[model samples]
Target: MSAAEELEAGGAPTNFDAMVKDMVRLALSSEYARVPIRRADISNKVLGERGSKQFKVVFEQAQRELKRRFGMEMVELPAREKLTITQRRAAQKTEKPSTSSKSWVLSTTLPQAYRIPSILSPAKAPSSKAESTYTALYSFAIAVISLNGGSLAEQKLERYLARMNVDTQTPLGKTDKFLQRVCKEGYLVRTREVDGGEEIIEYTVGPRGKVEVGSGSVAGLVREVYGFGQEIGDSDLEDDGEGGIRPTQVEQSVKKDFEMRLRRTLGMQPLRDRRAADANGVDAGAGAGADENEGRRRSSRRPAAQSESDESD
Candidate 1:
């Protein structure tokens, strides 16, 4: 039944508007710390006794208001990681992994036109270096973990950060505390394994990190750090006929190959121009000259080869 119908058939009357305001307040409170708001908290705090039967209506209405007013909406959290062997076994038994975390986090609902960095840059509200430190630590840590094939051993990760001088004197406190903060904030997930009394700790991208600072975000950081797709420090140049690297050939080689190499090194997908080329080639051979048709047929085998290469990898 609809919310109005439920209220009309009700025992005690619910203040629907008040409940929606409470839901918005609760979501905003949770979002201030970038933590998720639990469903139970909503049921108890936002819905209360009278609105319990109208929870669905109340939640949807609150979402619409959030999007309309704040340009954000509460997004349901993905399922918790199945870390233990028992959890994996249970998933296998069920033939489907668990799909919900019973929690929601506020995510931007802004239109693409308004989603640029210029429109969404941070304001001066941090008030302290430590707050900015928290942001930087998680962002770089998540990028490092993502670029390191989805997980990094604790020792290796610490070494990487240390090389960049992110140790004891970091604005956020000690290195250990920095790591603890990210783990607690759900930007990184830690797993420990014990074998022969040797404890190994590893870090992986947490669900929050994936949703916020994913591979695309990582790539954006890379492009902003280095000039877009350019090789850093040294160009991987091509040799011309005279046994010297030609700048013209170097440009073509980098254009065709450097991006793929960079993405491979960073564990990201290659640039997407190949897809556009493929799309443009749809039945294109029918209208081409004999020489062009020959080249087109030659190029057509490349996709098949690429498919096999991807499968092997």
Candidate 2:
């Protein structure tokens, strides 16, 4: 049936055109930007009920009028796709596949020379050692989150760590310790909810984690280690002339600020060469003082021996 016939059948009021126009104007206003523009939303706000035949007719008429008069079209936002249990598990597996034998060997037997500065490595001070461990764990957690589309299930995180052969037994399990520390230190945020009578935990990079992992330096490290870029959810970033993804100006500024903060937090020294220069300076100063003392004693002995020789003569 025609619009007029449908409106007549639906018993729309004589001033339906004006009312529809007003409803459309209100729906398109900035005040409704945060709330989605849907048939139900418009009906509830304008017609006082969602299931009214008059409202449906008016909604259709408004949409057609808006398009014809103002060249504006009403479009529905895309709904979020819900994944089934099998699909979710498949996605997790694809994101973090099992390590290959060759890769495992290379990672496990990698020499100290090949390790990065902020990565886990041998350190003299206990605090430095702890920092290295934390850094490694933080990097891993961020990588996992990024790989799994900016959030990781807590159980999947544990499975991924186990697959990577992270020692979970020593010192009360590094994986558990890392999770606790990251949450406490604001490097990662954990969200918990009950779904179908079961508690589920999810992890996402927190503010501190973003600062540490999103910087240019850390991005390079992540790319080198995981073969991926540092920007989270930046699958659309364009490649530069150098065969690398170019970061935006805002990203560059953020990275610079993060670098400065990291330097200050880590004692303003290179992660790989921390305190080495200070130790060398102390050793050199001590050696120089000992040499001077020895020289003075020798001169005093020489004078005393010369005086004795002259008396004997």
Poorest lDDT segment (10 consecutive residues) of candidate 2:
101-110
TM-scores for the candidates: 0.71, 0.33
Off by over 4 Å in 1: 1-14, 84-87, 90-97, 116-119, 123-128, 229-249, 262-313
lDDT per residue for candidate 1 within 204-257, as digits (tens), equals 888676655555455545555655533222333434457675566666565557
Which model scores highest in TM-score?
1
- What's each prediction's clash count? 0, 1
What TM-score should be assigned to candidate 2?
A: 0.33
Residue 235 CA error for candidate 1 (Å)? 22
Model 2 regions lying over 4 Å from their true place: 1-127, 168-174, 215-218, 226-313
Candidate 2, residues 93-117: lDDT per residue as tens digits?
Answer: 7866533211000011122232233
